[model samples]
Each structure stands twice: as C-alpha cells, then as structure tokens.
Target: MLRAENVTLSYGAEPVLEGASLSIEAGQFVSLVGPSGSGKSSLLRAIMGLQEISDGRIETPLQSTDIGILFQDDALLPWRTAIENVSLGLRLNGRDRGRAVAEAEAWLERLGLTGLGRRYPRELSGGQRKRVALAQVLALKPRLLLMDEPFASLDAIVRARVTQDVVNLVESEGIGVLLVTHDLEEAIALSDVVYLLSNGPHAHISQRYSVPIPRPRNLVKSRSHPTFAPLYERLWSDLSDVVDGPRRIRTAA
Candidate 1:
C-alpha cells in the first residue's frame, strides 16, 4: 500500500540517501538494515513526512492517521496511566471518551495487559511497557506500522517475547510494517523481505533478500530454519562488504 521510489535525502549539502526505494503491501513485514549513519531511519522519516526528501517521492493511499509509529523509547507519557495512554489518540481523534476507554481497554486486554491498565508506566516492567506502547499504537487500528528499533532496548529474552507478540499482533491484524533496525537476526526473523542499505554519504539499497521462512513465525524457531543460516551468512557477508568498501577505497587513495 506504500511505495518509496528512488528517494533521496540530504542534510544541508551532505546526502545521506540516494536512490533508496522499497514498497509495502497489506500484511507484509519489510525491514531496512544497514550500518550506522546509512539513513535507514532517515528513509523512514521521509516516508512519514517528518523529514523532507531532496528527490524522488513516497506514495501511499493511506492518510497520516493510517500510520502508527513505535520508537525504541516507546514515547509513553510519564504521567498517563496505561489505559489513559492507549486511549489518548482515540480521544484526540474525536472518539467519545467512554468509547475510547472501552476500545483502549480491549486493546490492552488483547495485548495481554488486561489488569495492568490502571498502572503507570513506572509500575510496569519493560516488556509490559512495550506491550502498552504497542497497544497504544494498534488501538488506533492503523493500516501501516513504522517501527524504528522498537524492541532494541529490551533484554534478549524480553525482546524475543515482545517481538513474537508484535509478529502475532500485526499478522493477525493484517497491518503492513516497515521496520528500520540494525539487527540482522531480528530482521530475518521478523520480515517477509529485508533490504540492505549501502553505507552513506550517498546511501542506497544495496540488496534485497526475500525471506524463505513461512509465516506465523516463531522468532526463536525461525533461527533454526534450514534456509536461515545461509541467508544470515550471505547478509552478514554483504553487510561487511558495504561497511568495508569505503575503508578499502580510503586505503587505496
């Protein structure tokens, strides 16, 4: 439902992205992975209209309200209780207070945060807070999700469980996702397709790998899939090449 075609982004005169392109359809899970400073996050910002692109274009039939973002910070309000936080968007969007609360409560329950609604963010564990944040986003019934390392801060175990929860929720809801992450294993485990970005100053998509694993995916079990290791190695090798390519050129110069 969304396409970014030959997009380019620049900060002042320094270009960060050039000819970077990708697309997403309903129920598809897509990821962008690359070295630090490669503009994976910038591409996402451009898609969201939070950052202006210098060239090319992003097209989507969905309105701004149709998109939801989850950042690594979760960005939950420190003062709002869980249910209040989840319902905030609905309330602002003109949903009736009672109806918004009811819908928010339902989303909290769906995300396994049923009894925790009354608690503040400080009262919840990391995983629980992440779920609350997710509930906050998904409660809006967004058509597309944009995640920027949303699970990166959680511990490995919590990260895995929350990742699986995300996979389950988004798949069940048929929402398309564009995730920007530095973790290749996480990318492989979660995405239908992973696009690798070349290193900046003028970064672009370097490779696209279609994940061979089937869906209703278990994050842990996906690692053991027959095709998983080989894909991981190939991605790792390609990532290394892109990271090293600049250094090699510098050395030659």
Candidate 2:
C-alpha cells in the first residue's frame, strides 16, 4: 500500500540515505534493521513526510495516505490522560467530540487499557503508557503504521505480549506496517519480510529476506521452530558485515 522507490535524503551536504527502497503491502509486516547512523529513522521520517527526501519517489493509495507513527518513547503528552491522547488525533481531524471520545475509549479497551483511560502518562507504568501510545495511533485508523522500535522500552514479558497484540491487529485489521527496530529477534518474530541496511554517511539497503515462518506465529514457539535458528544466523551474518565500529550491531533508538 506504500512504496519508497530509490529514496534518498541528505542533511545539507551530508547524505544519510541513498537508493533505499522498500514496500509495505496491505496486511504485510515489514521491518528495517541496521546499525546506528544507518538512517533507519531518517528513512521513516521521509516516508512520514516529516522530512524532505533529496531524491526518488514515495507513493501510497490516494484515499488512505494518512499514516500513523509510533515512536520508541511513546511520545505521550504529560498533561493528557490516555484517552485524551488517543482522542487528540480524531479531534484534530474534525471528528465529532462525543464520537471521538467514544472511539478513543474503544481503542483504549482494545489495547488493554480499559479502566486506565483517565490516567495521565506519568501515572501509568511504561507498558501501560506504551499501550496508550499504541491506542493513540491505532485510533487514527491510518492505512499504514510506521513504528520506530515501539516496544524497545518495555520489559521482555511486556514486549512479548505487546508484540502478540500487534500481530493480531495486523492480521485482523489488515494494517500495513513498516517497523524500524534494532532487536533482531523481535524483527524476525514479527516481520513477514526484513530488510538490512548498511551503515552510513550514505546508508542503503543491503539485503531483503523473506521470513518463511508461517502466520499466526506464536512468538515464543516460533523461536523454537527448526527454521528459526538458520534464519537468525543468516540475518546476523548479513548485518554483521556492514555494521562496524563500537556500534557493530547496536543501532540507535
């Protein structure tokens, strides 16, 4: 549903991304992985129209080009309650106030934050806050979701559960996702296709691999599958080559 074709971006004379291409089809889960400074976040920014591309093209369906973004920190406003945060987008889009409240409440419930809707970000735990953040974006009902390490801050148990919730949402709601994550296991578990990017001055996608593991995948069980180790090794080997310095495989959030 969204395509970035040979996209390039620069900060003044410095190039960040070069010839980076990827696509997110309806009901697809795509992940981008790279070392720090590989322009993963920059590429996402360009796709979200938050940054200007120096070259190439981005195309999306005309009717549903609106995209929802979920950042690693969750980006919740300190003064707003959970429901308020979720309703902000709807209200800005000129939705009816009462309907916006109702829809936001429903999204809160869907994201496992039913009674917590009235709680402000500071009052909520990290996972709860992240759930609120997820609801905030999902309530927009955008055609595509751009996630930049949305689960990175959560504990392992919470991240696993949230990942499962995201998988269900993708399957049931048919939302296309292009996720940028440093967590290789998380990417392998959640993505249908994974793209590896080399580090930059001028970062570019180096390889794309299809995840053969079947859908309705139980993240824990999927890891135990015979194919999982091989896939992980291959991706590691490919990523290890381009990601150098102390950064090696550790990318910025």
Candidate 3:
C-alpha cells in the first residue's frame, strides 16, 4: 500500500497543506476531489517526490514503487516526435536509445497512437496529445499511476473517451490509480472510491465514498441505477459543505 501520514506542503511561511493524509492500497483506483487551490496537485507531487512536504511523511512500498504521473496538459516536448517523448524517461534511465524507441513505439500502439508516433505535439489534437503523454508514462510500467485532472481541458466526448482509455489500460496492467479531478462524474465513473478533501492549512479527510458500483463502470448506467441518486446526492451534499465553506465555489464551472 502507498501511505501518507500527516503530510503537508507550504510555500515559505504560507501553508498549502497541513496534516493532510490518505493511503491508497494496491489495485485500488481512487479519486481526490476538492475546490480549486486545495493542494490536490501539491499532494500528488509530494507523493511522487517531485515536491517536498513540510510537515509529515509519504511512504511507498519501496523506493522504486514505479510511480507514473500524468499532468493536466499534454506537456510533451515540442521538438520531439510523440514516440520520442514517451521514450524519454526510459532513455534517462539508461535504456539503449534504440531499445527505448522500440518500447515506446509498442506502448504507442497499445495506447491508440500507432501510426501517429511520428507526429509532433503541435500536429496532434488535444486528446491525441494527452493520449501520447499517457502512453509515454505507461511505457515506464509504473504500478502506481498519478493523474492531476488529466481530462479537465478536453471536450465532454473526448474526456469520456480518454477516461475509458485510462480505465481500460490501467486495469489491464493491474496498475493502481490516484486521480485528482474536479469532474464529479469522472470521479464516479473511474474511481473505486472517491476521497473528498477539505481546503487547507489544516486540511482534513472529509469523506470516503466507496463507489459501491460494479466495474467496467458505465456513466450512463451509473446515472440511472438504484444506487446512483442517493450516492451522488450524498457526495454532492458533503462536498457542498466544503465547497461552499468560507466563501468558495461549490460546483465546477
């Protein structure tokens, strides 16, 4: 399991997160939801060691827990081809360049970007670029996938498609995911459990909503199910308290 205890982050003297913590177990798909500036991204970066926590600790099963991160934007290299961007981490890890390219190529094919490998970031659609970035990270074979509102910028249809791609690919790899998203429906559709977070300085675990629905989760079915209205209502209500608290906006718009 990946565990974080009393973890916090701050900029100089200003605390961004304080005593914020959560543990994600193996094979679990979890989502973190909160109002903007709630330090959701900060928490993920701290877990990945990309950012330092000021107060507490984050623990992975091992130092090499194979954590992969997908940012909101495509964040691909402009000069590099799509496949090249995917192979970058491998090359930095000392895989032979040719071998890395071949592996990246294979991942591209697996992620629905086979013939598009030669395209640059500028040449790809927003969805296409995001897919390539995902393919890039997956090539590293990380057992833990961390995504920071990855589909937040996509159109509704593209968001759905990308969510499905991520769900299908991660399930196939037996990779656990910790997704940070503003989209309520996305969290419901993709996560096995939704972790609702409070705003920080003293951020606390607000709620843990086990999706309690069947897998291969279809959003359409989720909206119409017996469990749907009640569960969604509860989540929205609880989240509403936090979202509306202290003069903050509740719904994402």
Best by lDDT: 1
lDDT of 1 by residue, 1-253 (tens): 9998989899989889998788998999999999999899888877878999999989999999999999889889989999999999999889999999999999999888879999999999999999999999998889999999998889999988888989998989999999999999999999999999998989889999999899889888999999999999999999999999878889999
The per-candidate count of clashes, in order, stands at 0, 0, 0
TM-score of each: 0.96, 0.93, 0.92
Clashing pairs in 2: none
lDDT per residue, candidate 3, 102-168, as tens digits? 9999988887887998998999999999999998888888889999988889998998888888887
Q: Alpha-carbon error at 152 in model 2, in Å?
A: 0.9
Residue 50, candidate 3: how far off, in angstroms? 1.5
Point out where model 3 deviates above 4 Å.
Answer: 246-253
Worst window of 10 by summed lDDT in candidate 3: 244-253
Better of 1 and 2 by TM-score: 1
Worst 10 residues of 1 by lDDT: 40-49
How does candidate 3 score on lDDT?
Answer: 0.84
> Which window of 10 residues has the lowest lDDT sum in candidate 2?
244-253
lDDT string for model 2 (3-122, tens) is 899999898998888998998888788999998888999898888889999999998873443688888899999998998999998999889989999999999999888899888999
Candidate that scores best on TM-score: 1
